[model samples]
Target: MKVKVAKTAGFCFGVQRAVDKVYELIDSSEDPIYTLGPIIHNEEVVKDLENRGVHVTDEDSLEKLPPGSTVVIRSHGVGKAVYDKLDGLKLSYVDVTCPFVLKIHRIVERESAKGAHIVIIGDREHPEVVGIRGWCRGDCTVIKTSAEAEQFNPPAEKQVCVVSQTTFNYNKFKDLVEILGKKRYDNNVLNIFNVLNTICNATEERQKEAKSIAGEVDTMLVVGGRHSSNTQKLFEICKKECENTYYIQTPVDLDSEMFQCSSYVGITAGASTPKKIIEEVQEHVRIKF
Candidate 1:
């Protein structure tokens, strides 16, 4: 059996930078360190950081922190309220929010200030989306599916600014945008609507790469945290291309039985996955199957 791993499979630029900064702080910083959330969606990385004395915290828990504690904002990025709260607490912080995500925040903040309704195309409850929502100075909407898009009924004259969560599925983002365009409101609304493709380049490349590899393989393995949005999107894309797709977080989750009928296996990982985990999965497939 030939097992092919995606070249784009592993930590994207933002995730790599955030994780690296945390480890650097662990080695150099004397103050107690905490992340506003898990630095990334990967459980293993978060657990490792916790074991090394880097505690995971939430915005509500900021007040409970001991004095002189330093907080690291995770790549998911928080809303403006979080920064304000941090300042109110007078706690020092290191912001490692992904640049792509930060760009969306700025766009939402700017557009909403100008009286445009902000429309975010992604999961409403996702930290990233929640953060993006916090940036809007005016009305904001989060639409995750075609049904949501169909039901979206903003005032006919509302000037809209549409942006996507950086890790959202590229094709789905397009579909949602298309649905929004077809909504039964004023025809002029499309003219005033500004749709920005905010899905990061890394995410687009990874999803496209997974689709291509999955089409050519007899079986596909998608590796990442179960709760990882990008990883889940990859799994969804791969499953559509190849029915024999499996989502696994680690080598232990792999079952040899799933590969019995496969001659060519394609492996791809989400943006937050670590290289070490991908390498171990690759090694396991090569040795066990």
Candidate 2:
């Protein structure tokens, strides 16, 4: 079997920034370190950090930390109220939020304060979405799909701005915007629709590459954390193109049987995935061949 790998399949800018910050802080400080949440979505990475004494304790475990302990905010970012809580505790910390996510929060805050209803196109429960919503003074709606967009009844009839989580699926964002536009015309709603392409360029480029590879290959191997939204989306995209797609977090998840009848294999990964994981998976498939 011939094995192909995407050059873009690994950590993107934001994940790299977040992961690097954790190491920088750990190396520089003697004080006990804590992350507000898992530094990144990958379990292997988080476990490695934990082994290094860089730990993520629950919010209720806050008091157990030393008084002067420094906290690192994860890349996905957190709400404004969470910052206030951190301040109330007089915690010293680093804000390692991805610049891309910060940009979305700014957009959400600015547009919502102007009395325009805000529509966030992404998973409602995602930490990034919840963080963006916290910035808005007026109410905002979160919808994951065109179906949600169709059924959604806004609190206000007119004046709205639309934004997306940085890692959200780009095509879905565009499709939802088009659906919202149609809804506006159907209701004769005087809309102030502003659609921002908040999806990161890295995500768009990697996904595009994955789709291209999936189309020509007999089977695809998607490597990344199971909880990674972008990784799961990659699996969905590849599965549609190549039905013999396998979603694996690491080489351990791979089966020799999946490769038995395959002539060509493609490999892709989520933005938060480390390059070593991808390389190992690629090497595994080659050995089987």
Candidate 3:
């Protein structure tokens, strides 16, 4: 059997930077280290950090920490309220939010301040989307499908601004935006309507490459954290092209039985996945089969 691996299968720039920041703090800081959440979505990476004395804390847990403790914000940016609270408590912290996500926060904050109603195209419960909503000073809507867009009804006088989660599927984001655009036109709401494609270029490239590899292989393996949004999107894309696609977090998750007679296998991973995990999966397949 032959094996092919995606060049874009591992950690993207933002995730890598966030992980590096945590390690840097661990090495240099004497105070106990904490993160607002898991520095990245990968469990293996998080577990390793935990073993190194890094603790994960949320908003409710902030008060438990002593005043001088250092906290590192994860790549998924938090709302302005988080910053205000941290400042109020006089805790030292670093903001490691992805640049693309920071751009969405600025857009929503500025547009909503100007009286525009915010519309975010992504999972409503996602940490990134929740953070973006926090920036909206006025009304906001989160829609992930055409049905939600069709059912939405904004105030007639309000202007609208549309943005998306950084890791949302590019094609789905476009579809939802088109549906919302038509709704605005049909209602004859001539207010200032703005649409921003906030999906990161790395995500778009990874999804495109995953699709291509899935089409050419007999089976495809997508590696990443189970709850990772971008990895789930990659799995969906791969599954559509190759019915034999499997989502695995590590080499241990791979089933040798599945690839028994497969002639060609492809491997890809999410933005948060580590290169070592991908290499392990690739080597396992190449050597065992």
Candidate 4:
């Protein structure tokens, strides 16, 4: 069997930078270190951090931190309120929010200040979207699907600005933006609509590469945390191209039987997935072959 692995798979720039910052602090700081959340969606990485005394805390737990504790903001940026709360607690924080996500926050903050209703195209519950919403000075909406896009009905006169989660499927973002363009709120929605494609360049490349590989392979394996949005998007894109697609968090999740009849297999991982995990999965598949 021939095995294909995406060159773009695993740890995009932002995730790598966030992970590196945490490790650096772990080595240099004697203070109690906490991440606002899991540094990345990957459970393996989070568990490793926990082993190294890097505890995970939420917004509600800011007051509970010990004096001199340092909070590390995860790659998924937090809302401005988080900063205020951290300040109120007098705790120091390291902001490792992905630059792509930070850019979206800035855009939302700027546009909302100008009175445009901010519309985010992503899962509402996603930390990044929630953070972006917190930056809006006025009203904000989160739309994740075509149905949501169809059902969206802001006031006709309210100018609307749209941004997407950095990990959102690029094609779907376009489709949703197209749907928004057709909505005739007072027959002037198109003129007032400001759509920004905020999906990161690395995510687009990974998805594009995954699609091409999945189309040519007999089976495809997408590796990442179950909670990872970018990984889920990759699985979706790959499944459409090849029905024999599996989403696995680790090499342990792989079933040798799945490859029994496969002549070619493609492997890809999410942005938060570490290169070691990807390598292990690849090694397991090669052993099976």
Candidate 5:
């Protein structure tokens, strides 16, 4: 069997930076350290970090922290108020928000403050989108598909500024933009239709590479946690390109049914996944198939 692996799979710049911050703090900080969330969505990585002393907490859970503990902000940057709470409590901590995500926060805040209605093109429930919404101090809406963009009921045509969550699907973003563009119906035009390409370059690169690889292989293996949004998106992308694609969290999740007749395999992973997990999947396939 010939196996082709995506060159850009695993540990994107933001995820790598966030994961590194947790490990570094776990080793250096003597006080109990907690992350605003799982740091990233990969449970395997979170479990590993837990074993090394890092803990996970959320916005609501922070109040339960024993006094004087450090709280690490996850890569999905928190709003100003959340950080201010840590300051009020005099908590020692680290902010490991990816520079790319930070830029989106700034963009939404600036645009919203200037009176442009903010629009985020991604899952509303996703932590990254939630964080982006926090930065906008005013009206903001999130829609994941072109149909939702069609139904979006913002105040007026030109009053909206479209921005995307960093990890949103690239092609989908372009489609949403087209949908919004068609809605600028006005002699009554709301006067300002702003579009900010806030999707992270790393995410775009990974998806492009994964799709190209999936298109060429007989079977595709997407590696990362089930809860990882990017990983789930990767699986969907690969499955669309190659119907034989399978999603697995680790080597343990691999199913032989996916490889029964496939000879050419392609592999890719989510930003939150580690390189070792990708390697393990490749090795597992090599040995079994």
Candidate 6:
């Protein structure tokens, strides 16, 4: 069997930096450490941190933290309210929000303050999208599909500014944006519509690479945490190209029977996935098949 792995597979820079920050805090500080969310979406990493005395805390749990506690912000980035709350509570925090996500917050904050209605292309319930919404001072909408874009009706007089979730699928972002562009023209609101390609370059490259690899393989494996948006997106892209694609968080999730007759397999993982997990999956495939 021929096995191929995406060059872009595994932790991107932002996730790796966030994970490193947690380990740094664990090694150097005796104070109780907490992450606003799982440092990244990977459960294994979070469990490893828990074993080392670090803890995960959410907004509800923030009030319970004693004064002077240290918190690490995850890469998804939080809204302005989170920072305000953290400050109000007098907690020290190391912000590890991905720079790309931080850029979206700044853009939305500025544009919304200037009377632009914000339209985010992403899952509404995602933490990153929720955080971005916190920055908008005016009306905000989340659209995940071309259908949503078609159904949306922005006030003709109000300017509209569009941005995307940092980890959103690139092709999908473009499609949604294209649909919105047409809607803007049809409504004669072209002059007031602005589109910003806020999807992270890492995400774009990873999806592009995964798609390319999937086309050449008989079966594809997407590895990452189940709750990871980017990983799910990768699986979506792979599945479309290779119908035999499977999404797995670990090697144990793999069924050897699925690939017994396959001559080529491709592997890709999300940004939050660790290199160790990717290697393990690759090694297992090599030894088992």
Local distance difference test, each candidate: 0.92, 0.86, 0.92, 0.93, 0.86, 0.92
Model 3 agreement with the true structure over 212-270: per-residue lDDT tens digits: 99999998999999989999999999999999999999888878777966999999999
Residue 151 of model 1, lDDT score: 85
- Residue ranges of candidate 6 with Cα displaced over 4 Å: 186-191
C-alpha lDDT (0 to 100) for residue 103 of candidate 5: 91
Residues 1-289, candidate 1: write the lDDT tens digits: 7999999999999999999999999999899999998899999999988899999888889999999999999899989999999999999999999999999999999999989989999999999999999899988989998899888886667688899999899999999888877663545444467899999999999999999999999999999998899999999999999999999999999897889888999999999999999999999999999
lDDT of 6 by residue, 1-289 (tens): 7899999999999999999999999899988999998888999999999999899999889989876689998999998989999998888999999999999999999999999999999999999999999999989999998789889887777899999999999999988888887766655556468899999898999999999999999989999999999999999999999999999999999897779679999999999999999999999998898
Q: Tell me the TM-score of model 5.
A: 0.96
In the range 201-234, model 5's lDDT, one tens digit per residue, is 8899999999999999999999988888888888
For candidate 5, give the lDDT.
0.86
What's each prediction's TM-score? Answer: 0.97, 0.96, 0.98, 0.97, 0.96, 0.97
Clashing pairs in 1: none
**lDDT score, residue 18, model 3?**
97
Report the lDDT of model 4 for residue 206. Answer: 96
Q: Which ten residues in a row have the lowest lDDT in candidate 1?
A: 183-192
Q: Which ten residues in a row have the lowest lDDT in candidate 3?
A: 184-193
Clashing pairs in model 2, backbone N/Cα/C closer than 3 A: none
Candidate 3 ranges with C-alpha deviation above 4 Å: none
lDDT of 2 by residue, 66-88 (tens): 87788998888888888888888
Task: Tell how far residue 65 is off in model 4, in angstroms.
Answer: 0.6
